[model samples]
Target: MGDEQIDAAALQSWLRAFARSVAEHKATLTALDAEIGDADHGANMDRGMTAVVAELDATEPGTTPAALLKKAGMTLVRTVGGASGPLYGTLFLRMAPAAGTADSVDAGTFAKALGAGVEGVVARGKAELEDKTMIDALTPAVEALEAGLAAGDSLQEALRAASAAADAGRDATIPLVARKGRASYLGERSIGHQDPGATSAALLVAAAASTLGVVVGG
Candidate 1:
């Protein structure tokens, strides 16, 4: 497969879509959190993405993927407080190196870049899948991306599969006991609650699908 073409306008549109989705689902996310967290995951992400969208609009970084991601990472780091800020910031920061020069990336390149981002998150948070953290969602999403690429899928197909995998991973978190982060403090009490990080990670993958014009399926 060849490198998928994405332009500055597409990237900008994706960011805007992300911000809108987070805002629209704010209550749902916070409600999921009220069961296990501080009930601020949605609010925090909404605020952070709002800032990111503003920066994207004001700066108009064009098709420089690296610069755009870097700016987004910095914005998240500065605006989003908590473990999420650092973790997500690191994910984008790590991805910048791979996405830096190209206006578009092929499925294989995107998969590799996303894998790097997931590794950064793992290293920063010291968390793993089934630990009731974002790793649950992100790991499976990246894996699915790899699988899709290996199968010679188009970038859109890969993104759609990745998004579906992420959603499933997010749902799976509900049955696992927390072993990291604030939720871990609850021990077995965390078993029935959804992981806020996983929820947000799923949102990220979903945003990717929407931006890339992938028709996601259940």
Candidate 2:
């Protein structure tokens, strides 16, 4: 059988759903940022995702998943503010090549793309686990997703596991002293504050579970 070209629509839906999730949690993200970092995580991500959706809507559809993700990455880098724009932008940009030339991406391919994207964030931000950054959420989610898939879990189940891991990673950020970004400036004061980047990253994973999980059905 051939690749399911319809998966392109599912990927598109995933991006749009992520935008909506960002909007829904904007206030919460802003509050988290206000606690330790620049108070613009929510606003910046919201703007970035809005631009992503608009760009996708306006531009002709891409021939492959890689092209779509690349376009989205460019929009984010061009539109968003703060350190998040570049970090998040690099994430998608890196994922583009990893997403491959297939018109439709399968569950394994999706996971691989996410892994590549997270690696980009880690490299760009120079962050690791417990750094109180998005990597905190992203790393665990990818690990959990890959683990779940390897264990023979369906895509929906794997995504659910990934979402749970991301949420836990986000929560774990609290009580840790910041080791990166503006939050590090606070030193000991950064302790006890939830990381805004991790919070939004959790949302990103959850959005994938709800959107892509439904469309692909593993």
**How close is every model to the real structure, measured as TM-score?**
0.93, 0.94
Residue 146 C-alpha lDDT in model 1: 86
Shift of residue 157 alpha carbon in model 2, Å: 0.6
Instruction: Give candidates' CA RMSD values in order.
Output: 3.0, 2.4
Clashing pairs in 2: none
RMSD score of candidate 1 (Å) = 3.0
RMSD of 2: 2.4
Worst 10 residues of 1 by lDDT: 1-10
- The segments of candidate 1 whose C-alpha lies over 4 angstroms from its true place after superposition are 61-63, 213-218
Candidate number of the best TM-score: 2
Q: What local distance difference test score does each model get?
A: 0.83, 0.87
TM-score of 1: 0.93
Q: How close is candidate 2 to the true structure, as a TM-score?
A: 0.94
Cα error of candidate 1 at position 3, Å? 3.5
